[model samples]
Target chain A: MARRSSLASRIFPFVFGLVVGAGVLYFFLPGPPQGGKVQTAQQPGAKPQPGQQGPAQPAGSTLAEVRARGYIQCGVSTGLPGFSNPDDKGNWTGIDVDFCRAVAAAVFGDASKVKYRPLNAKDRFTALQSGEVDLLSRNTTWTMSRDTSLGFDFAGVIYYDGQGFLVKKASGITSAAQLNGATICTQTGTTTELNLADYFRGQNMSYKVLPFEKNEEALSAYDNGRCDAYTTDASGLHAQRLILKTPDDHIVLPEVISKEPLGPLVRQGDPQWEDIVRWTLFALIDAEELGVTSANVDQQMTSASPEVRRLLGTEGKFGEPLGLSNGWAADALRAVGNYGEMFERNVGTKTPLGIPRGLNALWRNGGVMYAPPIR
Target chain B: MRWSWTDPRMRALVWQVAALAATLVTLWYFAAMAHQNLARQHIATGFGFLDNTAGFGVVQTLIPYSEESSYGRAFLVGLCNTLLVAALGTVFAVMLGFVVGVARLSTNWLIARLATVYVETLRNIPLLLQLFFWYFAILQPLPGPRDSLTLLPGIFLSNRGIVMPAVETTPSTAAFVLCLLTAIAAAIFIGRWAKARKLRTGESFPTLIVNAVIIIGLPGLVWLIASAAFALAPPVMGKFNFEGGWRVLPEFLALLLGLTLYTAAFIAEIVRAGIQSVGRGQTEAAHALGLSSGQTLRLVTVPQALRVIVPPLTSQILNLIKNSSLAVAIGYPDLVSVFAGTVLNQTGQAIEVIAITMAVYLIISLAISFAMNLYNARVAIVGR
Candidate 1:
């Protein structure tokens, strides 16, 4: 009886300590996102329908979370020249990078308060959906499936692009129709692969595809004579050509296979965050249409035009409802300049890419880049 | 029926049941949390995406596949490619490992030292770097199709791949195949019968030469009977690449070469240790009985060494199969690169896709372990 009492006394503290430790650890462990609410069914469309407002009070507000964590995390491409390539000093420079800065400028009033997460084609969507990035400003195509099924919202089109083929000049393949029984190299997990297949099937031609995980590998395969041609977005072709061994030896065929309305996106549950990203993009476009340049934004603030006054936040309280200061558009414009300025600075004719603003030009200038008026 | 705290048996049972309950609760919590999070995120989660069109092309496929094929078919194609590389790598590694392991124990100092050097040099380097070295440094610099090096009349080596003549089958090809199968079966039967006769009569037959003759001679005789049973279709140079022939891709060759060489080095070490584990007295006993050196090894050392060799050898093979997932780095289109990668990205079904991929690898590894364990039992020390 004494030995039994001693054994019980020995194990009682150990058992009690284990229960106490487990209770403490359970509280310390990070829980899931709070407040489970049913998600409103959204229509799967690239273009946002007019008069469709985001939820007034989100279950878990992304804006409040962003405010708690100071800087917005932006997901960009690993490296695409005029889109989101990092320079030698590791400072990212591209139109996509500038758009990220514009969003940061609007929210925090500081352009440099944003961090970049460079992602590949396969991991871009996963990274955004998992809340690793606040916005995906990468050159992602705005498609129906991505908008609805993937649980994302496309803010607006940043670049009106299309797929094209890049082939060596020595091969003398002048047109895409001539690429029969040819082996083409492209990046996997991208729309380019599907477009190539559809184009070939429609033309009643045959070809083989060598899909690599990254664009650099695909380009390397094409350069090593493993593939007859390379295919990607036409803007991407122009940008990637400059990094080739002999840029002058290749030519992009004059055929646009599919429409690629590249844009920035955010996750769908947080409607307020989506509205903020959408309005920031619209502000840049509206600023360009209203002749509000970054250098002259302060001077144009006092102009007589009500549209410019409203956009510059001089005549309205449009920014407050989206959870920002009244002068949010002014701050965004001051950081990245207008849309035209961004286009010309990164991939315009002056740059090595030398891409002309063809379909990306304003609607009044023989292009279809119109934005909804900020009423 | 009150529980007694001091009763040893009852206490042990209670603790075991409590631990099991804790583990079950933890696992259930994680699963429930994952499902809840997925639902709240509004991300589509299901295996229905397998029926959707893959809409992508793979460079090399063992089965018939096109862009119009479903994602499930693409997964099958990737799986076949992976299995092909793993099987070929295993066969070549085992053969080369045995040779090198035996050579390391050679009487000549030069051969032994050379074998040691080969093992040390290969096993020390990372497998991925070796893959890159074989792929980019060695193969990529080869001449293009226009300037291909003609190895023979119809074989060409280029950066694209190795282009060789393909055998075009004729009407008598099936007869030729049947003859080959019959010879193989006859050889096996003859081998067993010779073993029985040797035990019964105390005299050995020339089983090796006779079995060899049956296997090779029968195939040769059938070919001679049907002279035009097959024709060679040589590759013709086209505008961009060679057309209409068998082309072995450089990516596949690089992966196979890297896997075989790296694994063979480890396998060599295992084999050397296994052989040395056999007592030296056993060899001396066979020698005292006037048995030849070759016969001593075949009759005594190998059977004993196999018991020690198989368990570790199974590990190295499983490592090789898992290492094939690195095919994505060089565009080899293995299962991970195609299904887990491209399919996951397109469908945005991360939970389902990753779970499926992990389950497949688990099944493959378990199957290998089960088979190897059975073989290990067969070679195990059986005592009364």
Candidate 2:
């Protein structure tokens, strides 16, 4: 009995020590409660006191925080050919990438002052809202719920996209309506899933949704005939079709179901920062409309047009209103030429994506990319 | 007055108190921190979201569910999937483990070598790699439904899923249940009779043969009667899938196959160790008593070996349960995938989602440990 008592006594402290250690570890471990709320309160649209000069910082103040950090943390996709993929030389290019450069140029006057963080569709919002990225310029669609509920502000639409269905030509399916009772492959954690459901339900047609966790898996399943059709953003369908064993084997259906406004996003609250980002994009569009390509931007900066002079920082103090340097817009324009230049250089017919500028053209060309006057 | 610090009882009490205090303090700190942080982030810290609509659909739910269901329902679906995979994996692993364990001790050189090779090769590779190989290399290569690989009549294997003819029972399933109960009762009666006859007459009866006959024959008889009483429904092949058959999704098959093969290797090692732990003296004593090889193993070796096996085997079972979380990697919609990934995204409540997920896993682990301990106590040695 004495020995047993002794053994128990000896074992007691050891057990106690383990419990204490686990408790301490748990205490130190990072959890959502501690940091998440504070960050949300700091978001752009977060309420500020009367004396407070500007909007609250979202979780991470993307604008001021990026400046303090000395490098713009830009979120890009892992690899989407002709979008945000890495080049043969290990440099990131494409339209989505140039937007990141444009943001960097506006902030630091050097487009190269950026650190790209690759994220998946599911993780992109969290990365931005968590302040891991200064800007999210991935091929993400802008929607109402994402805008209000997710606590992020979207800069204007850069690409006008629509959802489309792709099926094998051999299946003799010409339209999406013909796909009743079909098995459709779609990627989970995106608007595509809801779009597919709404479209089918709206048409009073029944179909089976075979959702895959990744786009590649969905594509592979569709290619292997596991599903009768694949649905995604029309642009993504075109990009993925290029990699198929037989590029011509599948045909994208003509029916476009939903409007997908793709653009860059920043966490909400910092109105000053939001304006800076919004105007940077507009500057690119306005530059292209005024025929101010990167090669001629230097020359146009000295020209007499009051709108150009104001935009080029030769006439007004628009930059001061946003608390930026006078030449910020000019810096952004010089970084990636303009919106039209970015499109032609990245996903144009000259490139692999070969996307045409349909609804993405300037207002002068009868498209919807109209920017407010610089004055 | 003469008590020293080395006194056992004193030491044990001191240790317990110290441990208790430390645990309390640590819990207090984390609770404080979590409260503070959640308050700061404007994130709600509660399980209220469980009442909110899930707004997403699960691919393979055993229960009927829809997008309009609550988050609580989604959690149930995910938990069901996890249990489904773990149960199926455990069943297959035990059968394969026993075969391999026996083969490792086989007299035939080729069989022994083959089993040894399988154990070594599978044991070394990571489970994630095995999962990928099965999902990508094996399942993805299967032909589509238009040209499915038919294994047998009413059974087909394709890239989509494994389809088999299911026994479609109606309200008359009660008849089948009665048949099953009759077989079990017959088997028990035969076993008891065999035991009584052996004890009274000092003569053994073939209990195994009698039990088998009662179980199988009674079940067969009842099945016939049940079928006659009720119309038997047959499976028919439908477009894309079998209409009246049970279908196992490709994700489930991959996860189940991967987990079973991966865990069986570890189980084989455990079984080998247990058998080796039995003393040679016991076997020699059995031989001296003129006991046959099978009798020595069944009567002498196994009983001793089990004592050595049960404790470690308990831990391995717990490990298998915990490792089932890896189902997320292959998109099997286990607790983590559905609750943490999908629900978190839909709700925008990361803190609530993560906390719930952690709590669920802890509860599962604790339940397994409790069950294992109860079994352990029953099998433990009693002392005077």
Candidate 3:
């Protein structure tokens, strides 16, 4: 009887202690966000697919709220060079980074009033939809499903890209068609994986895909001969190829597998916020077409041309309807150079990536990047 | 209320029911909130996505899977891969743990200290870093398939993967296996009967030799009878890769190595504690009975130590299973990698995918505890 009681006593206290410890730990954990942070949801479509539960309180338009908040929280790529990578001083620089600066300039009239949220590919849309960021200027592709189903508005195509492969020169693999039975390395949870699958299947070849959660891991794995080819957007291949140990040894394949129209996206519900982001992108392109560089944006305000005057926001009230001052376009242009200038500075022919404008050049330049008039 | 408080049983029942109701209410509230939030966002909240095509390829699938397969099949493939790694990892860990645990207690200074250093170094470093080290630093840098390190005549190692021979099962091979299993069962039966007979009579049978003959000789006879039916198919070098036999891909090897080495560190310490908990008097008692060291350890120590070992060992096994989710970092395509990482992203069914994945882990952890508890109870001491 004594032994049984002793065993019971021992078991009871340990179990009780564990429960108590768990309770204490739970209380010690940081509580959920308070102070008007609303619960957010993400779906893909015009209508709620299964159910719809609106917020308890109307938080009002995302525009007024961002203005009230000091800075625009811009979500960007975790670290894609020439897109949204950070420098040695932890300052984010890239085409995507410059686009965020343009958005900040349009809203707050100061590009410096922008904070960056480095997000993974999978979480980028969610971050935008949840109001964790004012806008997602990541190197995200615009698709019909993302526009209608996910309830997001793609501002514009910032860069036109296509899926391709990088292989070692010594491997003598010049084209993706020769990559039959090849093992491909790429980042998981992205459209890149699906594109690779479609590309290989369409070519009537069998291949294996080894996916990593991070781009760096995938790159290193590919470098180590763990895979025969690495696949991503052509621009990403160009940018990331520089990091290879023997950068000159690897060559990106010739075939472009899938259309990747990379752009910035905002949530669908707020028209004002959507207009602000869209026109800001347009103003950058318009400024580029008008030969208005950031260095001469303030000087160009005195130009007599109606198009330049309207694009600089001096001849029209386009900024008024978008809920910003008249100099919103001018501010955006002055903060980040025109689209072409920003492209050249970060990832174009002048940069180490040495990428030709290709499909990203404007309409007059024989590329498809055309923007609507500011007026 | 005051009158009921005088009765301890009544008070206990009231508190218990209240607590149960509170837990149920909390659970219902959260579930409802999730449903409402998903609805508010226009996010489709259902398991319908599981019926859609997976459309992506997994690196290694034990079951039949293709791009045309449904997401449900993909989920199963991921589950099976997870179970395979966890089972193999646990088995390898226990074996390694026992050796290291015993070595820690050895009288040899160098061996004991080395075991100590191994345990301390591994247990302190994060498993993720260790996994990266094994993958990037060790496995990834191996030579290409054409220049594979020949481990043996039939085994090859390379950056592509490890190639080894696999058995080519034929019609007579099944018979050989069944014959071998039957021989083991007969050997156990003879051992039991001989033990009973020896207890009854002073005379003894040579049960050891007889059991060995039944176990080895019977299987040997089956093999001899069907000699031509079985053939060894060793891995052969091809132009670009191995032509035949099984290939242990580098990702799988790296994940398994990381999991086994990391979990074994904790298991070894648990074993060391369990063994130490056995009273010194028990060992001394076995020595006084003139039993050999091995017999003493087998009869007196291990069984007693198991009482202390099983509980913690169960936790470590569960930990190993959970830690296998980090396989995504190295692209092993385990449950989290395939289902949660890939499928969740593809379908954008965050809530449902997360819930289903959580339920799977819960079921697996519960199953482990259930099996371990049954074994634990059997070995538990009974009061005289």
Candidate 4:
């Protein structure tokens, strides 16, 4: 009986081990059989909406879900000078930084209520899709592929840019046509690299590309004369040109190769949120067009014009339809002025970027910054 | 104390089973979550995209490839480049390792110190940093083609690459290669016969001298006869760059040099340990048997030391294979760089691209292990 009992004990543990191993194997071996079924439950069904056919999200959904989380999760670049870079005190400041603050102001009514997450170009999309950031205000280009295929909604163009090339003055090269057979330094995983190829190929010019993982590396390479020229967004070139030890030693070529409509982005499947963000930008543009600066916003709030009164929360409930308070636009404007004010303060004539308001001007001035009428 | 139901083995088995079960449950939950999430996102989970044409062009390729070629072909190109780098790196590393390893045990103090310094300095730093130093700091600083550094004869080294005079094979060269193969086969047969005669009659034959003469001399004779019979075209240098000659890009050279030098440091340590593992008694016994130092090493030391060296050596080889992934940092389109980075961005299928890349690496690693196992089994000591 004792021998039999001992044998039973031995077999019991062995059996237990086998069972446990099987259990572990089961878990490790690609999950449950109904795995695919679980996924469909989370994805929303297709639906069309007016004003924007963007991805869908719940109406009046949790804003506290963003704020009680401490800071408004804002994605910015790793380091783009003048646009999104840390100051000596490690505080981020730039045109993109202000956009993040503006979004925070619209939500929490406090511009400083933000957590800045720096992301590289390659990781920016995944970061957004994975919901690591609530909004992406990096200097990202808006393209059809990114919008439709990648499942991301662009929140209106914040910066109208075009591709340009910068060469050392010593090279004496006046046109991009003369740059045939020359090596050009450019950042990889960007629209600029593709634009460079397209432009050169169209001109039937053969040039070697020296690609760098970071924009700073490419810029430094160009500065050190490692390549004959550097190419990127004209605004980026302007910003980078300011940091040059010998700024006058280099000059931007006259040719503008490709149009780059830069903007903030949000993940797809959130139309309610997309509309709110999109119109927030439109409101700013409209405010600027209607001559509503932050300094004069209080006076304009009581203006006789129905549109000005409607925008400043004095006359209409426009924000209620978008699941925001009537004062959201007024708060955002107070925090960061109108579009024209933000532009000049951040990257316009007053700033080192000195980007002229060419295509970025209001529609009445023959530019494309047109916002829908505030009904 | 007397053993009971709570015996050590029983306890161990029980604990192991519990741990395994818990791990399995966790894995299942995570897997289910991923599946549900990916499905919800409408991302395709299969390998159908491999059939799609790659829209980008590769700067350098060994095979016929175009922008319209399928992703599978791009994958193949990446794999080929990876293997090419690994193979070339292994050859150079072995040669360098032996020299450095021997020099470490040298009588000349300066030479020994130099080898020591080289090994210590290289082995301590990370391979990626070394690669960057060589590529960016060393190679990128080279003058442009207008002021390219000219080497002896028609060779030049610049930031672009190394341009060397190359030979173009004519029709007669094919005949020469055939003759060379035939000569090598004849030499092998002669060597076997010579070894057999030496063993049977207790007579020595200089097989090495004979084989060299047959293999090299016969091939040279055939080449001369072919050239006399038929006119051949030789490669000539052209303007700007060598027209018909092969040019090695600076990126490739930098990667190759970095991988080889860094890997050689580890290989030297392996070789040193391998040589030292054989006991002094074994060498004394070899000497007692009237064998020369060279013979003693070949017959006694290497066989035993190989048993200890090979397992660790196999791991180092696998490491070199994986470390080749760093080629992305330098713009060499190895598997990870081309497929995972470029292809993933182009296709916007991160999950699929990463999964494929991981699977390819796992397969390569497994194949290496399997081959090494076969070799290990062949050389393993047999039971009494």
Candidate 5:
């Protein structure tokens, strides 16, 4: 009798626990699992629930969510001087920051209604996919894998860039060909690392690479002579050189390597949100081609040209299809102006970066930056 | 049958069952929720990504690797780097810890005070700051490759790394190594035979000198015979940097130095407490028997102190290994930096990468714990 009681005591809790656990799980179960196409976030303001059934469509869920939250969540670089950097007064400035402000103006009609989440190169894409940010305006390269398999959509190219090298002037190395058997430092988890590998292989030269997780670390290593050269985008090399200890000592090599079309990105499964971001970039370029500046935007609203009139939302109601007011383009233009004004204010020849508008210029002006018409 | 309501045994059983059921339900609900969320994101969940090509380069690799290698190869390289630092750090920390700990209880006042200062300063400051100081402040200020600090005819030190001469092996190099191993085995056998003989009889032999002569003489004779074919390859300064030699990276040196110094501080305290646990009577008794201070420590006190020291020392070694993940901050390419940071970013498979990384650390820690526990059992007191 004693042995039987002891055996029961040893096994009773586990058996009882299993039965109770099953009952609790049954009570909390969602509806029956479906085996057809997976449901996407298409219904505006609909929270994610299991067993949801609907055809995947762009129902403006992201826009409705942003409206309910009263602000746009934007992901930018940690601190790239001319791209997306914070000033001494905690106010963000540069081309990427101004682009987010333009989006906020189009959505809420208030350019100040935006919050910035500073992310590193490694964490930028994940932050956008996880719904931590509505738009990632950091200088991210658009690749096929990221746009499809990684579940993201590239809006449009904001900067036409290419990989370049920065070497010290005293080294007397004038060209990229002289960098054979050199030790190069670059930021990790970036296209710059892969491109460095590809370029060296194509040249059939031996070199070593040191990949740091941040830009400043890589630059510091190069400055301290731990590396013979530093590599990144051509514009990045120019902007980062200003912060080095001896900016005049280093010179950017003339050879351009892989093409890097840097742009903003959003998560997949939301066509409406993707269209809004894509056309916002188009509106900036279109406004520039039509001779409309932020200062003259109010006057352009009454312009005689049909193209300018359509873009300023006077001749057509194009904003309604994107779930915004008819004055959306005018508000966006008033907040950050045209693409040319943005480039000149942040990184053009007049600014510290002094990068020329070579490939980023409009197609009609012998550059490849062309946007579809508003009509 | 009827049950008694006021029986203490029955009341305790009812409470236990209820608590068990509640805990199980909570765990089940969380696992279900995670499953649902992952399915909704449509992110692939599995270890299949390990076979894909890793298209990036690592600063240092222990084995053969390239951009065309698989992600699995990258993970192994990271693991090797981590193990190298952790193993070397543990050996150096224990040696330093014992020396400082013994100095703390010394008869000299200045030595004891300096030892006290070292322990207090290191243990109070954070390990991450010390790593940054070692990497950026001290090492980064060194000269470039053009003007390297020449330590010897064949060795150079600079901000890039420490370049040293490497041995160019000949056909007879394997024969020389075999002779060396034979000498080591002979020395161990002779030492054991000498001890057994001393126990049987009351006479001692010159065992130390004999073993030293055999170990050195046998390897020296073999090397002399192969000198005609052997060569030493010294580093040559190239236009960019040093060429054709073995180099030790500054990142590895800084991380090893920081980890050893920080862990040795805590270990010094544990050793001090252990030595103090041995009673003063043991030393006094050894002195009355005409044992010197050195003999008293090695022969009488340390064996007893080992009973207390081994357990806490095990935990300190474990802490050092886990702390090596901070190598990412200094760019050492340890398991966390290359696998969890870079591979996770490239593959975007957070769940699998994180799970595998955690399992690796856990397994390493468990293996260390198992070995230490066995050692602890052997040294433990045997009650009558």
Candidate 6:
């Protein structure tokens, strides 16, 4: 026993001493210059020198990179009907995917010059920031913290949304306040979860939250009576409600707890790339305002009107500064129709979602959506 | 080089030193690379996120938790939930395993066949599928809270959870707990005393009776004394669901049920192998000493079987603990689901979160092995 204990005693100190010594070495040894400055706030366009032997990835050069690679890497949602969903043949469509295709057309003059990567809410920010995707066209909610802190810049609002609750009509939960002590289900790792807590806590009510990694799982749980209510974007509730057994049996609550301006995003450092995407979104909306339908875009290209000619790339060199051909906007408009066309094709009153264009209509049509003109 | 290689001890030492150096350099390089990448991407790396408000709620929590609580508290809640599942799973698995293991060796043809079928069926099916079956198939199809299946007067099962009556708080709860601890201490002392007396006199003392009286009778007495303040709280139905009772959420039930059923199969095999390992002559020797079949199996077979049984049992326990992390699939708020999934996503601190999570499992596995080793040493024949 004495000998065994002595051996244990010796072994323990040696192992512990090695650990202590290694820990000390780790702390004292100087690392790279950029590693220590862990800034709480992000500064866009800030570039630390690249490694000695590593390949150069200059900040804000996404356009050149995409051109060099011969395809744009666009991050989209895993599946959200009318926003980003793959059809039976694995062909991706919806407003978000349309924008990705539009960006591809602008860059390569071919709508198919893009590879789609499906991202969940948690992975979208990292995927964009890590240069895994050239642009993020997922239905990501644009927020101040995500824009500044996470090094992402919102290009433009593709869909305006707000947090709302979906409950069975049989339960008669009219307002958000009536959901006190009710269990809510939502997709985990999103701003929607935080909004759920804030809304409940702000009202001095307690609610059990059941979070699922996948939105479909959460919706399934809500359907199976695992939760009393499902909370997410108002638009999402409308879309998800269609999949329920009796869509008419559930009601979207009146309260809009938080604003969720759903938009495409890009890494913050790339001003040129950000402009290209921002303009692509605006081009769609502007095309709608200019009455440039996909059917009439070819004919309009021959029109004598200067603004119409400029927009269709018949008069000016507008796309040159954005590092593209003048026909880029025309290609984008042709690829996915205009913004109105994109909206009408997927999520408008005609679609299964049957959602009326409430806040998503153009400003000229008495709605908040207004985009800058292509000069 | 040949001369140095001829000395095995020296060669081993040199190789070990070289491997250690290589490991250290690789780790250092990776750390440097990670630091550079994080910096280049402008992602902060630190444990500061632990202090940030979790800003979310969980379906079930043992300890007091709120959206206002820090991420650290959420981590603690997740850890507690994990331990709760693992500890309960271990106990149930071992109990069911011992029964099944013994049944596999039963002389009755039907009983042995049934046990064999059970072991074979569960051992072959994947655990994740079983967890899904329990969660999505079985529990989900149950009635809603309003139409819960009432098993008894105060016991109900719904999709939300199994609700049952429980003892409400007592004003003298601490005092009662204290008396219970003292009773356990007294029982241990009495057992030792009896053991010593039997060694000296060769007349066995009834330690079991003394232990039962001390352990149960004392606790029962305390409960009786405190019965005035203690109350049973039955679940009260409300507008939408039940109001007050001890609630076990379906996620917890599914995870626990799945883990126990899956792990018990392997543990049963281990137990069977252990029992068979004990020599037939040992049982014969016990019978020759006028011991009954039951007594021979108990006094001679089990004690010896335990020596062989414990090591493999420890591995099974560790597997159960690790498998409990699959709770994420069924939305059980275990450590992986809450801390690693939600917390990691929210804070975007993958390195720190994953490292801590890996360390937690490592430490838990090591500790279980340590405890089992101690028990194994005690059960091993002395001076062999």
Instruction: Report the number of the highest-DockQ candidate.
Output: 6
Best by TM-score: 3
Q: Ten consecutive residues with minimal summed lDDT in candidate 3 chain B?
A: B36-45
What lDDT does the true structure give each of the candidates? 0.86, 0.76, 0.84, 0.76, 0.85, 0.84
Put down candidate 6 lDDT per residue, A1-375, tens digits, no spaces. 323363474355446445534532342245453353333333444544323212324544788889999999999989889988998999998888999999999889999998999998767777887789999998888887676556577898999889999999989889888998888888877888889888888999878888887888788899998889999998788889988888998999999999999998887555678889999898888888888988899999998778789888998899998989999999998888898999999999999888788889999787778988777
Off by over 4 Å in 4: A1-45, A48-62, A169-172, A178-183, A200-210, A220-228, A242-249, B1-32, B42-46, B201-213, B228-244
Lowest summed-lDDT stretch of 10 residues in model 4 chain A? A48-57
lDDT score at residue B321, model 6, on the 0-100 scale: 99
Model 1, span A114-153: residue lDDT tens = 9999999999999988889999999999998888788788
> Candidate 3, which CAPRI tier?
acceptable
* Model 2 error, position A108 (Å): 1.0
Model 6 local distance difference test score = 0.84
The best-first sequence of candidates by lDDT reads: 1, 5, 6, 3, 2, 4
Tens digits of per-residue lDDT for model 4 on A1-375? 123253454355445555443433342244334643432222243543332221223333325457568668889998777678888888998878888887777776788998999997767877887778888999999998677656678999988889999988877788888887676877766777667867877897766665556677677667755578899899888888888779999899999999999999886655667777788788889899888988988889889988898888898798887777887888888888999988888788877778888998888887888888777
**What DockQ would you assign to candidate 3?**
0.32
True contacts kept of each: 0.44, 0.15, 0.37, 0.11, 0.29, 0.31
Candidate 2, superposed: residue stretches over 4 Å from native: A1-46, A49-61, B1-45, B170-172, B202-244
- For model 5, how does the per-residue alpha-carbon lDDT over B206-253 read when each residue is reduced to its tens digit? 999999999988878887876523568898888899988889888898
Pitting candidate 5 against candidate 6, the one with the higher lDDT is 5
lDDT of 4 by residue, B1-384 (tens): 334556888777778879977877776666556544544443444466789877555556788876668888888888888888988987898789777876787679999899999999999999999988987888878876456688766677777677766666667777788888899899889989998998899899888998899888987897777673234242243322234445677768888999999988988888778878889899899999999988987898878877877777778778888999898777676877667766666566676677667767766776786677657656666545
Chain B TM-score of candidate 3 stands at: 0.92
User: Would you estimate the TM-scores of all the predictions?
Assistant: 0.90, 0.88, 0.90, 0.85, 0.90, 0.89
Model 3, TM vs. native:
0.90
lDDT of 6 by residue, B238-312 (tens): 766788888889999999999999999999999999999999999888989999999988888999999889989
Pairs clashing within candidate 4: A24-B24, A39-B36
